[model samples]
Target: MSTNLFSGARKALVASIATAVLLGGVTLVTTPYAAASTTVAAVSVSAKINAFTNIDWLNGVWRTGAGFSIPATAANQAAFKAGASVRLADGQVRTISRQQIVGANMSIFLDGAKLDGNKVGAPQVVTIGSSVVTAPVTSPTTVTAHSTSINAFTNTDWLNGVWRKSPGFSIPANDANKAAFKVGASVKLADGQVRKVTQVQVVGANMSVYLDGAAVNGSVVGAPNKLSTAGTTTATPAPAPTSPTTSVIATSNLNNFTNNDWLNGMFRASAGFSIQASSANVAAFKAGALVRLADGQTRKVLRQQVVGSNMSVFLEGAAINGTSLGYPKTVSVVSTSASTPSSPALTTPPATVTPAPAPSAPDTTNGKPLLVGVNLSGAGFGPSVVPGTHGTNYTYPAESYYKKYADLGMPLVRLPFLWERIQPKLGTPLNTVELARLKQSLDFAQKHNVKVILDLHNYYRYFGKLIGSNEVPISSFAAVWKQIVQEVVNHPAVEGYGLMNEPHSTNGLWPQAALAAAQAIRTVDSKRWIYVAGDRWSSAFHWPHYNTQLISNPWMRDPKNNLVYEAHMYIDKDFSGNYFDKNEQFDPMIGVNRVKPFVDWLKQNKLRGYIGEHGIPDFSPSALVATDNLMSYLRQNCIPSTYWAAGPWWGEYALSLDVTSGKHRPQLPVLQKHAKTAHSCTSIGPL
Candidate 1:
């Protein structure tokens, strides 16, 4: 799960500038925060390497390096190093040449023939893991409506493929609707919500009608017979008066809550929440059941989970007010009044209820592979140096780099950086120096019409501590990401957040940690994509072994429906980009085979996929064949990828795509061939 590490630095800047935020129309011009001076524990490679071995690397060839023998004692483990003779479990002595974490043991190569006796030879993998609007019609009004017959085009973009807009609704993108649902026009919902058709999203099979962000019954959706000449309006209906009675059935003490609940149409905890529960109360508040709460809110129960003496209940409606549910106070749960509006329960009595569709992977790419790009490395280098000196220790891609790549048809660039350098300390504002550099690179990419992935290239560790460890709490991870997103919230060139560069040895906590950070990011920006990598170095070959969540229960639950899983693949004996053996031959399908599990997993789970890192060193013609084959396979699957990489400091590196004399590298051409395929596939507006 390791890649070649590099170093660079960020120089502080003091200035104010305007930047566009994503997901809406807002811009901010603010001064940068000064860098902070702090000390952190130096990384312990043995601890890190030991953690990586916890997973089974049945697909050994895809791991970073190799190891052979097991260390029998704590001293032996500490003494372990390349070229050190280590005692095996059988007491046999073996010299360690190259070692990598491969599923609960190090896969070592002794003198290059590659014999990883730790069950590393086969594929022992198992697996795991928006809007609408409307308007009216006219002029033979190219608009037509069917109440519920035509299902809105479903894609991986939204759950049930629903593109919902509050106060608005979505309709099938049939020919007549496409012509009639024009922006600036108005559509009146069957209930009398008059909304302006703000925009239209036509990508592959998805042609959505946005009614300035509204939701309505599909049957009532259609073009208005005529245009409205005034401001938007919603017909209000007089409330039916009733003397509803409330009977207190149960009361419980509120323990805690969070605001990131995912309940749709149901009243959800705006922040997470928990209450003491016993067997008696758990059943009384089952899904689809309605109850009146002291907060003056009535909602249908979505679901409930009980662990120990605590229960978490999700309800459908507007977000619940956590503050109103006073802690340490007994909250009354009352029987619903006959006078209050109600819907059938979400569970039980199937004949009377239709539960909301479970969240599904959005078909964002429209069955076509996403766009191809290259890793613009450098900013993430020099992990050992905190707030490293810019230029000497680290650097970001220049404007020319973006220009050259965009000109070459590579419209995406995955930019990696150390989380430590940006924030310096957890829960603190980002260092102005690092922030300015990142913004500069983003601006350059946007100018070139290229999308960028802001990769937190910290290897799932901040300041040398694995995330979720006491030293690095998961909340800190979420906090950093939340702040980062706030800084660039909706920068147009920003594609997604590479949550981590390559995570390894996360103690089975990566999934929870990753999701926590994602939820935090969503709190600020919900429209941008979030690229999640698997544990065990995010290896496509070993994805199933390291990440074993069932497809039925995906680990990622993005509130915004833009979560894309990422994996890395390198075609070499060790799956490391070093390529020490220059003349090694490779099967043309080697690259494809290594990455197939990841692709297949994505398919089985119905999720989006991305190849975050894949590279072949020069000097091996067969590697080129393998690279080309892998690229073709990705194109056929409609998955996007970024080559491993092009940067300013990678002088003479085998896999470096850093340009020289204005000439393109051999690998660049291979990537270029697949880059243009996504261009015509789907358009979600701009990068």
Candidate 2:
């Protein structure tokens, strides 16, 4: 027989024997022919193929039988169309013929014969273990196949542009190799060629992958040399874990404060952060942050809150401005565990400052009757003349002198005292003898129910030098008054303190000295009125020309408002009592007209005025008319006036009202008439 016929006959016999084995156990007759057939069947069984329909079972070694068939599916057809090698059960490996899919079945063309699917039970998948097998790729193949062998590759279609792991590297797109690819695993990049995705930002139309490790433009996988997802690729780094946040408390400074929004109860500033007048800042302050004020004092921030974009830090217990904070200042933020130290006390400004509070307004009678009084200088002007020698001491009259005046129905007396007599030397104790004389007069006045205006009878000087001149400091004058007040301030008969007897030659120092003395007197005695004389001999005619700053400025204000401006007026044209020699030239209305400005100024400034000293020479028609007109004007204005003098030494002097011998001067009746209305004076007839 030919080799072909024998091969065909053997294949047919193997098929028949397989069918018989499937039905039941085969009974073999012990003969030479039967043994030969059995041996052939056994040989064929050892070389038969193990077929599989499922792809997963095709992993290990498999063999091809004598009549192998291929599946008609595209995945199978494409895989076998490229001729594949497979191991037989007998350990013999052979190359399978290329196959193709025809409709729902397969067409196999071997060596020189064509095989169709009709002879096979179903299309078989021929796979082998330990070795990769591939077939000739048919032209116009509709699908691509993946390997089923241990060394097989992954389908590029299955990759679909994914990242896959390679040896120490990553392929970032579709790749044919499947050595180390996984679903969700991390892998390393190429050795010494590391890369990091610093940022993944979207560009105009696509995402830009920025890498810090290497200079590569990361684009989609379709580009040349670009990595694809199908291949083994390194994995991206996991995102870093988030860190937790911490909170802290802080404070703000006043210098940085921009504005306070009162409506919102917020304080805004240039500082980066704002503090609230409500919770946090307030709580922190109560918790103890010391705020230093502009006055160099520290206060706790008692309340604070944040409203809108502003902060409200309250220095006082409540949230307010000015009184509590006073002025904005430095703030020290203290920690919770620390204790705050006390702040220094705020100091008050001196009273001489210009912006000080105005003194209280003087007593207001609201258009009451005018008061008449007398000026007496015997106790203050001098000592009894020492033959031909000048003496610094003054010989004041005995207490009976004042008693006599009080007995004459004098309600008030302007009693003068020399500053030199009271304080002979700067900073020395007041003269005891002079003070005793003053006390004696005060006692007499008090016994007789008369008010005494204690006068400092100096011509704006202590010893022929101006009070505030270089030779005699104004401070010394103030010291003297301060001492004098200590002695006489408590006396009930002391109606007021006359700041000066007649301050001429002051040269602008009168205002400063007067104010100083008034302030000094005020320190010890607040209720008693103070008579502040004007500059230039307290002249009524010169009142307008005097520096009115002393009365106008608040700094010179007597805190008690018990100040009466004292002005002196003489009826003569020169405002000098020495004009008694020219008494014939006196005009009754001239004195009244000249004093109008002084009265108008007092009214304009809402002040009180006292004519400390004013007089006409005698009861002549001109003198009486002048004196009456002056007194009538003073009465109409409700101003108080005191006649020039009744000193024991002024005997026969012009303008003197000396009654030592019980004889009445001609001007006495005019005085009694005007004064009788204000006090309890006797009604004396014309002299």
Candidate 3:
């Protein structure tokens, strides 16, 4: 059978043809994908006889104004439809397949007869039939029937092939989840009640399931009841409540977190945390376990502390965008109903789990925070010029710039450099000139006690080909990382190796490729942290959509447990650092809202996180507020962040923190204020 080769854009407009169109007896089972843009139900069209001439060969189906029948079996039909050889009247034979259909520009005749073998004429095409199917309206909280694929224990996002493995759970993509969770293809629930996916949210790791715009009672979908205030399933018994009581949970100075065992770890809170516990949860909490809070938040109870006096109670979950907002002013104990005789009324558990006070904290200059840093740019510019002249096409950060930021109270520097400039050839030794320039920067950082994270800002591609693709094999990618690790494994200023800066379109191979690169680094240096960025530009907002495999246990294994996931976010209109609009308005909460997904994912996986890059343009005052808010949020959660940039060449760049005309940029004061509060970095452990 002949077919019209539609362009990718035109293909989206084509829908399934319900009725069988007999073209020499070939049956069109289904179209490529149904049109989802329309809300009206699609109407099917009756079959009609059509014909055409001149045909292409060995690339796709080849026929001219003729009809043919394919084999009845699925396998036979696929093979026959794939390609077939036919003889022309001139004794020339041509094979047909689906490769060269691009730009074929063939036409179909509305009325024609089945041609006998060897009848050749101008190249002809037969446009496939299309009919739209009923689809639901698309809205902020509601998804179309064509887009609803999530079920009780699974979601449409997990099945999108971008994630190679599952996290053993599925949650809808809502404003809270922000993995940019998209249920792109069509799927149906076993109950058939999920015709249209309505509102559902993933706050932290807990998911509130919904179906057809109605709340689901139990953890399972299609349940026949609503959730009660007790936060129990309809099948489970309610717990007994006591009363809301006040207690002096902690009385020590508020600044005592310096050596606190819990606060030393990332995302760990010292006080202002409580959960309505079940019997199992109570046992888990008392044993210093990771308990899921009644409100669907999760935290590992490493230790609980009480150190203050006359602490009035605030019986509410203290969280910012679903993360532990550190140290509430007062502590309160709210009584909770017990589900069983063994379960006690919800009260503050005894603080018996505290381990020995953390070892002497790392040396700090005036007790400056560990992760306050600036992104040192320059080496990564001029992507089109490979192995270009250093001074003209690209340049490394000036030695003085490192000391300037370090002396200005920034203790860390993220150095971005091109991979091609470093190696010149893939899988080869580092270029000596580039290597020397990098070492010089490291030396300057060491002199000023400033940590450095080397960023490979390649955007998951080298010479325009994505890593893990045929042109750039994962082995080559891993090899380069291994060599770089070997060189700086002993450098005192080297904080860690950023595997890649904002990897995008890695074709779902990011998890595998990152793991391979990390394993290679471990072969030389296992103590230092390796920052693994997620696919799709390492976007914190879209972390869940493309990075489930990286978080999935055993999918990405680092033997040393020193892996820190890196994510990037921007508060501009497009989430890109380059603010095209001079006067972009923004909500002060934009920064907090965008990074919540990555932070929540980190907390859920019990892993540390780093914001490798985030910045705001100077054009908008709201941008400054958003920046300050983001820094505050990061500080509260103990997540490290580096501003987008500071380089000698960035003379007029809005986000650049480079000192120009000896004047401080508008963002400097805000950054310095937050930098002073940083007392910890990813380097809490050895190396």
Candidate 4:
């Protein structure tokens, strides 16, 4: 909900070079434009974060539980240091942290993690986030022929996983009736069955084909069979198209593209993506619209098409360059005169052309902004199965607990990982069991299309001493962070790391040491958002000095820098709670009277912060009053907050509400009411 925040110095770049543009063969570059203009807000919006102007990634402070993006540019450092929202993209005009947005010169969000785009060898390694190669700008279309081709076959529709172009789509298919395949162009098959043709049996002069050594239907390549891909048997009847035509998964959004000197595809060298088209696809594209993004040249729009919830755009076909078949084409999309277009994917993009234009500089969505997220441990629930099916650790009701949270439409989730169970021993490292469980959980997050924060929960020690031991040595802490970085950092649903659960410390050294540990992570993992406890009792107002380094550290540089200083909002006990004492009771004025101070202080220092911990007690629905008050306060101030937990606890505590109890407790209604609002909390809904 709360993403990039930038305020301050304006970035002025002369993207135009004062030289004659290069024109190869029929391709010609367009004149550059160096102008600025404001237009009506478009229905399509994008946010982009970058590393420029020597920016600071995490500088904004927490207002209630929300974080503001601040500027940290050198020229605007003073103003950014003073705390002011300069300007962020997507009409985002909010004050951010000094380290994040230097007076509006930068922004921060948990989008990418552990980026590695360098080429090591055959597999061009690109870690962190999902990589998209933009080429052959697709012109949206109404033609379902391509879709119908695959839809026409279910079990026979090739493999049941993602299909990628092998060594480019240029490889000609043995089937003369079908068009040539493109390089690297892949499709995901939902259900594909393997067939085996071994024992040949004659049934009254009739023959059937066997799949996986079992005959399902009488089928085989009719007529004189081709030599390459073998299979000869009785021809089977064509299957009726059960689903809609066309089998292509609509992946029109191109963010970062690279390949080709052709103006056919899309690729964004600077930020986001750029699109162009293949030469052959371009000629075909002329039937629709043809244009290229100045940044990337990966696509060309071929036809206008409609897709998604309620969006319409030109549909474009992607065929890698130099990938085509000389065989007579059966697919009507291609022209006969065409030498058979080659596959669209090149070895590496055609050449590093200009990148795609940065998505309207990363900024938060407009209107009164409030982020909602769920904690799986308290307010939500998954399956409460008996025994652990996969992982070696004992299974509880937690998995079933998540079902309720997902139903409640919780947008953000903080799923806890019991360290004692994950790493029962001290020196022994993570194994395949833990890996599989983590993968399954992450897969759940992705399937549900929600954000999840990996929560490490436990009281364990590494290197012979507990985590918060003397000075909290950096080396020991790094070990903990390294595991997370390697294991789950790249998962799309995973936003970033939550260092410790209900984190605390009496000595001041722990916070600084943790800060250092985070900084070390920054050295390798650049684009992840990190949540660390504030200080002492995990309160934002606790250690002013320790919190200062997060703002004043040397490593706090880069538009991708994402660090969040977290604090607990529990007015009572941690997991189990009675209810807030009269002192911290429900107050309609909490946002203004209490939470405002925290916001104002964050504004003053320009630091990003969050309320990472808190929840209601068991059997005490009255706690809803305080929860609503706190939630209301956050909404009023644009603070993003996550509820205490998701999974239901049978324990008799006020803060530990079970989502699946189905009794509709008092707080359930309160939470339900808020769920209707876009800015309401999402950490405590149905699984």
Per-residue C-alpha lDDT of model 2 across residues 303-371, encoded as one tens digit per residue: 444433234454432222333442233244543233444544323321221111232211222212127
Off by over 4 Å in 2: 1-370, 383-393, 557-559, 659-662, 678-687
Ranking by TM-score: 3, 1, 2, 4
Q: In model 2, what is the error at residue 428, expressed in angstroms? A: 1.4
Tell me how far the alpha carbon of residue 185 in candidate 4 is from the true structure, in angstroms, after superposition. Answer: 70
Q: Which scores better on lDDT, 1 or 2?
A: 1
Q: Please estimate how well model 2 matches the true structure, expressed as its whole-model Cα lDDT.
A: 0.48
Of candidate 4, the 10-residue stretch with the lowest lDDT total is 3-12
List, residue by residue over 1-687, the lDDT tens digit for candidate 4: 110110000000101101111111111122222222222121121122221111111122222222332222222222332133433322334443323321112222222121221211112211112223322322222211111021111122112110121110011111221111111112211123323222111111111112232222212321111111122112122343455342211122221212332112221121112211212222333333332322223233334321111111232333323112111111113222212233343333433333223322112212122255666652111112212243322332344445565556455667766554455444357656766666677787666555677766532233224565663444656665676577776677676677765444334455555666677666667766776655444544343543555455544422245655565554442222333242343322222233344555565655455666555533232244446545544553445666654454433223333533333233444454344333212221100
Model 1, 584-637: lDDT tens digits are 878546787898988888776667788898877654545665676677677656
Better of 1 and 3 by TM-score: 3
Distance from true location, Cα of 301 in model 2, Å: 76
Off by over 4 Å in 3: 1-253, 256-369, 553-559, 659-662, 678-687
Candidate 3 on 1-687: residue-level lDDT in tens? 001111111111112111111111111122132223434433221111112222322111235434332111111211222234433333444443321100001112222343443344322222122344444443323221222223233122222211113222233322222212212112233334323323222321123333243333223422121111111111111222355432212111112232333231212332233322212223333433333333333333344432221111112222212133233221122222332212222334533222334433344321223666888888887777776888998788877887788767776888889899888898789998899999998998887778888999887889888898888999999999999888888888888899998777677888888888988998998677788888877889888777998755574543355787888888766666656566577754578778888898887766777888887654454566567667767776777788877876765556777635444355776677576552334332112
C-alpha lDDT of all candidate models, in order: 0.57, 0.48, 0.52, 0.36
- Model 4 whole-model lDDT (C-alpha atoms): 0.36
Q: How would the candidate models be sorted by lDDT, starting from the highest?
A: 1, 3, 2, 4
| Better candidate by TM-score, 2 or 4 | 2
Instruction: Output the number of the TM-score-best candidate.
Output: 3
